[model samples]
Target: MSAPPLNPKAGLRAALLLLLCAVALVSITAAPAAGAGPGSPDSRRGDRTVVRTEQGLVRGLSHGSYTTFDGIPYAAPPTGPLRWRAPVPATAWQGVRDATRPAERCVQMPAPGASGVTGSEDCLYLDVTVPTAEPAAGKRPVMVWMHGGAFLGGSGSDYNAGRLSVQGDAVVVTVNYRLGIFGYFGHPGLGAAPPFGLADQQAALRWVRANAVRFGGDPRSVTLFGESAGALGICAHLTSPTAAGLFQRAVLQSGSCLTSFPRGALAPGTPAYEPFAPEAEVQMVGTRAARQLGCTEGGNEEVLACLRGRSTDRLATAQLMQSFNRPAFGNGLLPEAPARALASGRFHRLPVMLGTNHDEMRMFVGLSLAAFPIRTEGDYRARLTEAFGAAAPAVEARYRAADHPSPALAWAAVLTDRSFTCTTLAAGRTIAEHAPGLSLHGYEFDDPHAPVLAGLPANPDFPYGAAHGFEMPFLFTPFPTERPLDEAQRTLSDRMVAYWTAFARTGNPNSTDAPPWPALRMSSPHAPSVQSLAPEPGGIHPVDAYATHQCSFWDRLSR
Candidate 1:
């Protein structure tokens, strides 16, 4: 999104709204529930098989088309003494470890309709899904998925990658990292320590490097892919010096280094939002959090010791956790904010694919309309004034309420272009600017009739046409859609899988089965090189997302 300048208090409010964006993922109830640790009985023990990791052997369950090894520890549990520290190697185990079920979800804010905070602190685990029928030739490509939850929620095991693995003929690994306070908390005592959640992702990538070959996957041919908060994490990794060689390609869905929201984008008076904060700011918040928890009157060690000793229930409160959702820069894992890093040409030079839904902001606006009404042009104008101040008239001229079916829809369109769509395309241009030879491509998932995720609160008059996260079910299985996709949507899913896996295999999504996906021309002002993906005939062609979304207007406004 185009960045809007902000004041301090609005900055805080914007950050909180940033975390609330994860509510989109939280409302989707289709992901699998996480199970217990080693003690959980392996119900498929009779017919299950084993795969060897560098640390030990793990048993996986077979589901005819694919095999899944769930809940394999990637690093030592970041509990007790290890809290706030960088991840260490998971202790080697004896004999075959049960991997039939998912481990406890990382500590996180409770989802809607849930009771007290739900998950365990010992949550540094990963899952592997491999097609039963391996590639006809050598090792298959490996894809590691990072789930989105605003870094306050989501488990790696939640996604059922069986469809992705089987259809693409690739090995897919999903990861679970520390969330909210437990993951992003920073402190002066922890001098230059990286975000544990980000470190956890690297640890998982290291684990993949060590054992992908054993699972019949090419260790060097790995693709890192994710959505929302997960994509932001990947954004950090792209600029993180330590992340070199972890993967060969990347896919950023619905997020980018520059992705941000303008003032009043989520609700009236809320400031502009970005997914990252500087290290000093994060430490300041952590210090305030410690004092609020009554860990005052102590030195660094004493304060941290007291804070760590506090119960998970106390720290996992919605306020404290949500406050620390933005990952910190100026540390080893992230020496600078990703937005700055990308602009200055300081990111990994690998093939990358990034995009957003055509109606990205509709999901957020639709969910909040009940709370913040925009029933007419006057209300839309008021929102513009609240968000843009002197520039409200310019924004209104470009995004008139009458151009859409309703004022609320018009507001949603404004947020989408200025925030998700343009920011993503701009990030694409930055990547190309830095690495002109890099294999780069982009897309817009514009399935206007894309199925709504289960539990989303959408008004009947306001259809969430191709809104945020609606494209997930096309690639990941068990992504509980409110209803099943019809034949055309199913066919579109097949096309997406082909393009994605083809990209993973060779850093190119182009294939014989689908329309050619043109590369984003780095120097073009319009940059009309992104593919448009939908189920309709001729929907999979290239479109000028930058020009189409009125990015030039937002760019001028941001300046």
Candidate 2:
């Protein structure tokens, strides 16, 4: 049957509906199964593993190849009077606590069609996964992961660290911090700092320092890594004075200090986005939120009390949560925006690996097409005009729609180049320029046939093509995907695991066995080298990232 013509209002409504559906789908994918504890039944009976933290003793579950300790509290829950305040250390407990089950995720807006919020306010937990077999004499390198959900949703427990632990020979820790309003809200009542979320992450790192030895990990060799918002969190930590010495190395995937979205890049009417907000702006939003919740009738303390008294359900709605999404600056946590700090050479001089996907914006643009159809040449031009303003004509000329399979693909390419690809390359160049002594590396995951994640509807014409978060499965096992990797993909996955772990162990990604990943050197005569990671034979090679992404054009536009 022929499809009917697209109506603007109907398309928007449908898009909104699909967006909600997408969130709900993600929620389902993210939720853990009914009684799957960290340890399996055999591990519970045969190989009981217990570790002692500063707080208390905890028992973990043992699988055949790895051991997992889940639901270990690193800090007290940010609840009641503690809302919007810095995370406090977890109080010591008596007796061995069960670390088999994952803790509730921090309070967050329920996914659309969900019955209620899926987590608790008291949710500052960290999970550790280590290889079952002990290393000869040296403690393994530790990789602490922070999950990404635009800083609004996501939990540490949702990811399974078995593969990274066993294959990479590393101890992996995943953390759950406060999210959305509970995590990032700033106001007159709240003292200066980045946000509770960033604070919670620091607390988690401290916990790892104190307890990593128990899990066969070297506290001094910890590597902090994350994708998207998580990577952005790493960016903040790199610039944060208080975060000095927390970790020795860092890895940022698909996000950088300079990451920003132009207006209408996501959808027809979506506004431009900045990851961080000034304290004053966040305070204004908090004040307005307080008024909306009927908490504005008293002094700052009284108003804070009123806000604290509100039910989690009331405060965790989607709109309220998104209102506090950006972390506030002008505090101890971040004295200035991270990008500005990086540009001024104010960030820490440490070995870093940062990169984005080959098609970072395809997932976003593909999801929005149902609601804001861009089916024709004119439609594509209109979107360019909305996003690039006066430069739209030039952008259209540069990324001609006739070159791509469809208008949607063309738009996605344009957004990807302008937003993620160029911005990340620029960030690497800036870092190389400022920290000339630091070893910096860049990469692009270009597995064109990477598995599609669960929940995103399949579109034949517009393949995901190594879109945002697609590279996650290579590092972590059992990521929700439509299909598992084949033999060739598995080989690539193994190589990547080796590269990541080698980098974590020694501030450099190249090892004797794997392909050599060149560093981003300021003195290099050639354009900066970025390793290409793909499944095909000879797929992993260095490319001139600047020329590939046409970063010169973006640099000019940005200036």
Which numbered prediction scores highest in lDDT against the true structure? 1
Name the Cα RMSD for model 1: 3.8
Which lDDT tens digits does candidate 2 get at residues 132-230?
Answer: 876745999999999887777788887888888888889999999888888888788776756889989998998989898878899999999998889
* Pairs with steric clashes in candidate 2: 39-61
Model 2: per-residue Cα lDDT at residue 315: 90
427-500: candidate 1 lDDT, tens digit per residue: 98889888999999999999999988886776888999999888889988668888888999998999998899
Residue 113's lDDT within candidate 1 is 49
What 10-residue stretch in candidate 2 is worst by lDDT? 1-10
Clashing pairs in 1: 1-419
TM-scores of the candidates are 0.94, 0.93
User: Where's the lowest-lDDT run of ten residues in candidate 1?
Assistant: 1-10
Residue 92 in model 1: lDDT: 93
Cα misplacement distance, residue 514 of candidate 1 (Å): 1.8
